[model samples]
Target: MRKTDLLAALALSAAAVLPAAAADEVNVYSYRQPELIDPLFEAFTEKTGIKVNSVFLNKGMVERLKAEGRRSPADLVFTVDIGRLNELVEADVVQPVRSATLEANIPAAFRDPEGRWFALTARARVAYASKERVKDGEITTYEDFASDKWRGRICTRSGAHPYNLALTAAMIAHHGEQATEEWLRGVKANLARKPQGNDRAQVKAVWAGECDVAIGNTYYMAKMLADPEQREWAESVRIVFPTFENGGAHMNVSGVAMTRSAPNRENALKLMEFLVSDEAQRLYAELNAEYPVKPGVPPSELIRSWGEFTPDDLPLVEIARNRPAALKLVEKVDFDG
Candidate 1:
């Protein structure tokens, strides 16, 4: 081959081999919004010198991961709701994480039995009552909504939403399916309007005098209060952490998992451990307004001012297991109707 031709052939022969993640890099597939979680990742990178790549997804995490198969670039999966996390586990896309740091920081109830997932933060499903209309101690328990006293006075989003489904599934755990069915029917009877809008909308309903109270997640109060436009909506309602007659307040989680196809397993596990560290937990409470998963780390000032209560000890796995039945109950009751 001539010199120019030989050079061209050699350059062509040098295939561009796409390497896996660099030694100091980890990739994440997340269902949570990037803005809410970016700070945590940024902090992780700052402290550990590991580059974190995040892919945000609203749907199809399982399908995408399944499609990627063993060649998937995802090292960790971050998502909210036990239902979605369980979907990953059920789909067999995530592998068990055998980290002592994870086991030490996370409670057994919040960790999967086989160690496939770990709860990083928790949110309680609580009631939001109109400050003007509802008495301070009038509704103190989840069962209170089932009383005729709350009839035509309560508001909530669709019962089948994963948040509500997890809460309902908890009801089934504490009370039998039969009794939970009765309680749900009673709660449905009390709807101030058609099961509509989101957790924020339910609070907005309370502000508009459309309802006396609404059932929603505890963190939403901080979120609403943070927004200038929604301040009035937040101010109109008081958070009520309602306990079950037989258990603590129902809670849900946003969690993390190691992908079965992780190419950077050590760095991925480092990121996981960092996430559960005190610095990261503090950032989570302060930035995202979520309750930290690590013990001894208190929530932000806003959450503390809301008062403290025991989170129900029912394992999230137990709650997730009942999601199908919970959805069936929501449909059976025609809750959204």
Candidate 2:
């Protein structure tokens, strides 16, 4: 279906499930799947007595909001990836939030300096190495993906994918464009096959013996382990938190922003503050298998079992700014070809 039509259908589905508008309620336009966020919303409503209405859009959230202008029903926006969050800021669809609660709960590295967006959870871009073929420390840094040692033994999704692009942007932030381009070419030369499928698919390739190591997010390990059909694939690989030469693991976030045209401004601010609370952070960590952006909140036991590593201190906005250059390098390398 066309993107517009698909968004409309998703809106209708959300409307059909939501109750009639309540006197005290907040509306959300989310790129996150409903199942992943509904529990948190339910808990918020139960505690605060403010209803939460959400429309799950697969894409075009900024466009929809721009089109809706001052009449938009959305009070908040939620999405994965710094790139998407940056798009909201760039389009001026979201306004700055100045919640002391949010600033206190979240670290400086994970939030917008201007308070335009705040990360709810974090996930590292890690390596999934074959337990049988790759040693515990065989893959140490993301730079290792381009080493001659792993040629024809690496698997990843399209380099242009937001997840990969974010990583690429980070490389640029650290190594400069020309060097990052060289690194991209080297990594591309190492691909086991044409870039295909999701992060899970890359791990499945390792399980199938098509590759020795794959690039993917840390959360996928937990997700695969929970799925009955994909358990073997999860078991076949060990999670490796690779870092830059002198930096820590590469991390990305799923974040929230307040809409500029928030109709329920007061309730929306309340929800925003609530999302950073210990209860909400725990729910996010446990339910989604993500690292809580709020310090002092523990991740799920399953995620903890994978081990931990320091996250790179590079500001996410820098990553977002470097994205266009990263995409150009991906095209210049023809990474998926």
Candidate 3:
């Protein structure tokens, strides 16, 4: 079925399960998987007596919200990646939220200047180095991936993927366009094979002796370790927190935004505030194996085991702004081909 059709069916199913006009309820259009977020919703409902209804969309969330216009049932939109949040802001479908609780809980670096969006959790773009083939301290920075020593020894997903694009954008933020392009060319030259598969697949390649290092997110290690089939792959590589020359490790986020056509604005605000609470932050960190955006809240023990590094201070807005240039460079370099 088409993505829109599937979204419509899921919306209808959600409506059937929960009252359409419930007096105390909030609706969400989320890109996050239900299993990853339902527990938080349940906790919110239990604590506040507010019903939470959600529709999961794999793609086309901004288009769907645009189509619904003022009648859209969505109160909040949940998604990962700054590029996606910027899309909602650019579409003018989300409104600015002024909440003291949010400002105090989330750091200034992780939120929008105009209060249009707030990040909930953070993940780093890191390397999964083969335990046997890669020695400790051999890889310490993202720039090392482009070194001649790594030629034919690295693996990654498609350059066009949002995750890779964000990383590329960060490169541009650190080094100007020409230098970033050169860096891209160098990294492309090091690929063991054509850029293919998701982040986990890169790690699997390392396990299969296809490459010495795989570029991926930190949470995937926990996820792979949890799955019995991929446990061997998880065990074969160790997470490496590479930095940007003088800066720290590169970080990305999963964030939330309040929609403009919020029918239950009050309830939505309540949920938004609740999501950043210490309790909720802890739940999110433990459940998703992510680093919570809230200060004083710790990540799950499993996540902490991967070790820690200072996060890059480069603002996410800069990364989002550089996305167009990043894509153009990717195409120019033909990183995927």
Candidate 4:
């Protein structure tokens, strides 16, 4: 064969071998419920011809990944809350991938600056008040919950709850630790009853007339509204969009990251890109009742019905960053008391 022709043939052979070198399946460790995240996985596989094998767990994924170490088959990690994602990154379990697609789709406030993770969806932590008992235009912000007027009328889950912990962290980030502690004290003084139960229970307290107001994630209301048995729990309350006195509502995210030792690196990246795309962002909203992180994607009907407001815009990383100190504050205040 002529030298030029032979070289071209070898290049074609190398190109053919490249596909074979890639991993056939991507293993995922996901904190999302299977039902909520499965459609996106199926769509990704269908489009890219890369099979996804996932272990869905509500918790303990971080410890599992640590235990497995380099022997782990996981190529990607997914979870709600910046703290969990930050925990994985801080543990050296996640690797950074600087993808322009990720940067463009997700806001800087919702992602790790180092590219360690990208938030896929956002949910506001806002208050729900009784339509009759709580006067409209009375409670305009989270800070107001500390006022004496709200004493014996406010309800909230324990501060130790991850959701409330994150919100408290945000408060500390914005108001300073001293001010945040003071706010907590005032809020505590107003609690109709001791902080207890999951966020859903707080809303139920509103329904039972035990409290006039409750703080919870936006999605919890949707969950309650959808369940026939829990309709009564949702019916008595109306969502109040708290402006937080000056800043917007406090928000947090569900995020995704590639494992540091990801065997299916390329496919893992493809899945990450697919997740932040407009189509998938909308799916995230529709399936999970959370706000899309991507700009311009309209929120699901449940969220829209609750009305729109500006988000707090405090960098979400701070929520994770302040977690330790926030927990300390929660402990010092005896938030469960």
Candidate 1 whole-model C-alpha lDDT, 0 to 1 = 0.89
lDDT string, candidate 4, 1-337, tens digits = 9755654554353334222225667778788989999999998888889888877767666666665566566788989988888899888988899999999999899999999999999999888889779887887988788889998998898888788888888888878899999988888888889888888898888989999999998898889988988889898898887966668999889999987778788888889999998888998788999999999999977789898788998898888999998999988988787
After superposition, the stretches of candidate 2 with alpha carbons farther than 4 Å from their true spots are: 1-22
Candidate 3 per-residue lDDT over residues 1-337, each given as its tens digit: 9877865765555445433445789999899999999999999999999989988888888887776667678889999999999999999999999999999999988999899999999999999999999999999999878999999999999999999999999999998899899999999999999999999999999999999999999999989999999999999999999999968999999999998988888999999999999999999878888999998998988998899889998899999999999999999999999
Clashing pairs counted in every model: 0, 0, 0, 0
lDDT of 2 at 39: 96
In candidate 3, how many Å is residue 258 off? Answer: 0.7
Highest TM-score against the true fold, candidate: 3
Cα lDDT of all candidates, in order? 0.89, 0.90, 0.92, 0.84
Please provide, for model 2 over 1-337, each residue's C-alpha lDDT reduced to its tens digit, 9 standing for 90 to 100. Answer: 9977765665555446544335689898889899899999999999999989888889888877776666567889999999999999999999998988989999998999999999999999999999999986678888878899988999999999999999999999999999999999999998889999999999999999999999999889888998999999999999989999868899999999998877788888899899899999999878889999998988988889999798999999999999999999999989999
Root-mean-square deviation (CA) per prediction: 7.5, 2.4, 2.3, 10.2
**Which pairs, if any, clash in model 4?**
none
* Candidate 4 lDDT for residue 37: 91
Off by over 4 Å in 3: 1-21
TM-score of each: 0.93, 0.94, 0.95, 0.92
